[model samples]
Target chain A: MRFSVLILGNSSATPMYERHPTSQVVNHNEQLYLIDCGEGTQMQLTRYGIKSNRINHIFISHLHGDHYLGLVGLISSMHLMGRKTDLHLYGPAPLEEILALNFKYSETELRYNLIFHPTNPTETAVLFESKLLRVESFPLRHRIACTGFRFQEGERPAKLDIDKVAKLQIPPALINGIKWGLDFTDKDGKVHPSSELTTPAPLPRSYAYCSDTVRIPDYLPSIHRANLLYHESTFLHEMKDRAVETFHTTSFEAGEIAKEAEVGHLLLGHYSARYKTKELTLLLDEARSAFPHTDLSVEGKWYEVE
Target chain B: MRFSVLILGNSSATPMYERHPTSQVVNHNEQLYLIDCGEGTQMQLTRYGIKSNRINHIFISHLHGDHYLGLVGLISSMHLMGRKTDLHLYGPAPLEEILALNFKYSETELRYNLIFHPTNPTETAVLFESKLLRVESFPLRHRIACTGFRFQEGERPAKLDIDKVAKLQIPPALINGIKWGLDFTDKDGKVHPSSELTTPAPLPRSYAYCSDTVRIPDYLPSIHRANLLYHESTFLHEMKDRAVETFHTTSFEAGEIAKEAEVGHLLLGHYSARYKTKELTLLLDEARSAFPHTDLSVEGKWYEVE
Candidate 1:
């Protein structure tokens, strides 16, 4: 299975000439999940050739314009394209009301079903579950009620050791049982352990997205051991005071969080427009000093995780 | 007075690779007014060097995502920039509710007062008045309750022919009276007719913005005599069936309306993404067949009214 993330936008608060606001697309297998669609997200999707109609689920972190302004436009475009598949939207309580009012005034009846699942941003709980992945939301310390998400792949069955099974003359039915972590018995009633015939599968991969938050150490437990982690770094270490005042995190602070969480890799984005493109390298260097796997999130770039 | 219109975005529903959605900035003297901000409008404003703080009023024609999606982001950016001026917003009733919900959830204490003026899309009435301009909304036939705005500049005082006034030995006070279209009377009580001394001031310049609407003949009376008119031409004449079904107008239809209204200049925009830049000239030609003064609206291009 292919698990990756495509960065669509990364600028914070205000959009500048070279950077855009917050938006990212998470690709798992053949499905795409959109997260925090800011203004011009649809344009980014078009530029990247991502079929927006294939995106069945969207997760909005909060009501901030930079986090969700593009949602209405994205939804409207889907309707205009004659989409008929039901779409699931998860966000704060008031988001649905806002969308409903807009549709009411425009007299727009979407051909697709827009199922809204309002989440409580103050608590940690499971937000979505499917056969391939399970998503959970954890609280974040911000000016508003904000939450971060953790996506982990479902458990996989054990793999059969073909050489060992063949040498042992394991039947096809017994091979299936061994893959399920069950022991096989011989005709003479001799017990054969499943571990002897099969090998354990690799650990399920996971990713965590944390944005628009200050230092929230409490979330480490839920986000720890992620294969890939994306966090907002709105400022550099020199502007830590401003970052705290604005409920954002500095690059150094984001690196510290990734190090403490022991995530495999850290991708920092949501840069303040004040910094030029060259300054991003300096910020990434500061982050990498603490978390060696740190990298800057660039728009239109994709990061793949096994 | 300098009267000009800056095209910020001209694409239809979905913003394409080379075209952006609907947005325009009208500059009258030193004041600026924003009309129909689509997604990514803030970035467009930055690209064109439009100071966001200078826009004190915003008018939205409808609740379509392409028409008003940038409003919340613009408002948020204003707050981020520490603006203290009040902003007047005129739009459909549901917009107020959406803005309120966003503000409520974001926990944003706006630095400026957002004065929302709810507009009834079904009625044609004066929506706002300022020292320099009077704005009125006229009904338009669309898929929803949409309206177009007519911006009429307040009448200017007549300019005195300085050479003529000086040659006639008119007093300063008498010159002011003549500028106000009053007859000048000499000390001997001899009456002077106003027409003999001064010509009528140029008719008040006006601009009308009709976006995402069908060619409704009834609107000609409300928009007649406008110095400049911007109308949506979402398709070509061959797509008339699609235009009517979607409540949009073609280039030919847009020109027909402008010709019927006798507008000075017709600006055609809101192009369908199906056409490329090379096709724009052909579309303009089609429009000019009916209205000789028709022009295509291009992004970052400004049109000045004499």
Candidate 2:
């Protein structure tokens, strides 16, 4: 099984030559989830060769134009392309109204079902869950109501040992029980230990998307122990006042949050458009000073979650 | 003085490889007027090196997502870039409500003034006029309420013959009178004919943007005798049925409209994404069969009005 995240856009307010606004696609095994689609996301998906049809779940962190302005365009394109799969969208309550109003003006009678799941910006709860994955939302301190999403993969089943099964003469129908660490008794009443038959299952993996938020420690518990954490680093420490005023986080503050949450790796994105591609190293260096496991998020690059 | 139209995006519905959706900038003697901003209009403006601040007026032809979805993003970018000039936007009535909702959600307090002018899709009328140019709107037959725009240059000032002025020893202060086609007189009361001192001004240049429209004859009088006419040619003669069903036009019908309207030159655009850059020549050839002066609109190309 493989789990990864693809960066669709990393720029903050404005989209530049190679840097667009905040958007990314999370690939959990083969299932796809999109987060924070900015303008030009469909183009970015084409640029990266990701099939838009594979994305059934789209999680938007906020209602800022940079974060979700691309929603309508993406949906419109999907509708034009004759997509028939139901789309699940999770965001603020006003987002539903916004989408409805825009659709009314365009007179777009969507061909597929569009399901809206409103997220409370001031509470923590499980937003979505399936057999293989679970998504949780936590409050963030920002100018407007916003939330961060945590993607947690379900615990994988134990791998089967074909050789051991054959040696034990286990029935084919009982393989699932054996894989679940069940002991097998032979016809002659000989007992076999479950631990000796199967190895332990792999622990679940998790990723957190925390962006467009001020440096606040209240949400640390919700994001604790994430395998990979992507936090917004919109400015340097020199612009701390501006960051505080704008309800955005500086690189140092992002690092401190990552360190406090004890995340395995910290990926920094939502860079201000003023920082050129090569110039963003200053932000990385600032974050690394607080947390050594910090890395810059390059657009269109995919990072694996271990 | 220069009057030209820059093709920013030419593809219909879906934005493909090199062609984007409907967007163009009409440059009337350096005053830029934007028509139908698509999803990447801001990026297109940046790519074509047209300063965004230079655009003061924008006209959206319809409420389709591909036509005006980018307006809010463009305006937001302008505000972020510190644009202080008032922006005038003329479009469908719902556009104002949509912008208001989006701005409210984004909490954007624009630093500059934004004025909205609503258009009625059922009538032909002068939508905007200034000292240099006049823009008229005419209804277009489509699935939804739509209209086409005609950009007509104001009556040009008469050009003065510098040699004639110097030979006649006319004062520099009276050159304005000569340029205005007023007869020049000396102290001896001998008058010079306006035609003798000044050449007749070139016929007022005009360009008509008739896109996302079917080949309906109702708009012919509104766009009669334009120097250049851009008509939507979404399909070929083979897909005439599809064109009629979608309320689009075939290339042959586009040519017929051009021929009937007596336009100086016909530029066909808003092509279906199915036509590659090389395949569009078939459309041009087909259009030329009905009107000999038809040309394909190449993206990023600027066509002179005269």
Question: Largest lDDT belongs to which candidate?
Answer: 2
Model 2, span A138-245: residue lDDT tens: 999999999999999887777776678888888988878776777889899988866677788788899999998998888898889999999999999999999999
All models: lDDT? 0.88, 0.90
Task: Please list the residue runs of candidate 1 whose C-alpha ends up more than 4 Å from where it truly belongs after superposition.
Answer: A156-200, B157-203
Residue ranges of candidate 2 with Cα displaced over 4 Å: A162-177, A183-194, B168-172, B186-190
lDDT of 1 at A162: 83
Quality class of the docking in candidate 2, CAPRI style:
medium
> For model 1, what is the alpha-carbon lDDT of residue B266?
96
- DockQ, candidate 1, vs. native dimer: 0.64
By summed lDDT, the worst window of 10 consecutive residues in model 1 chain B runs over: B159-168
Cα lDDT of model 1 by residue, B1-306, tens digit? 788999999999978875898999999887899998899898899999999999999999988888998988999999998899999999888788878877877777898899999887777889888767898998888888788999899886677677777767788867766877898776688877766677777778999999979887878888898999999999999999999999999999888999899899999999998888889887899899999999999999999754
TM-score of 1: 0.87
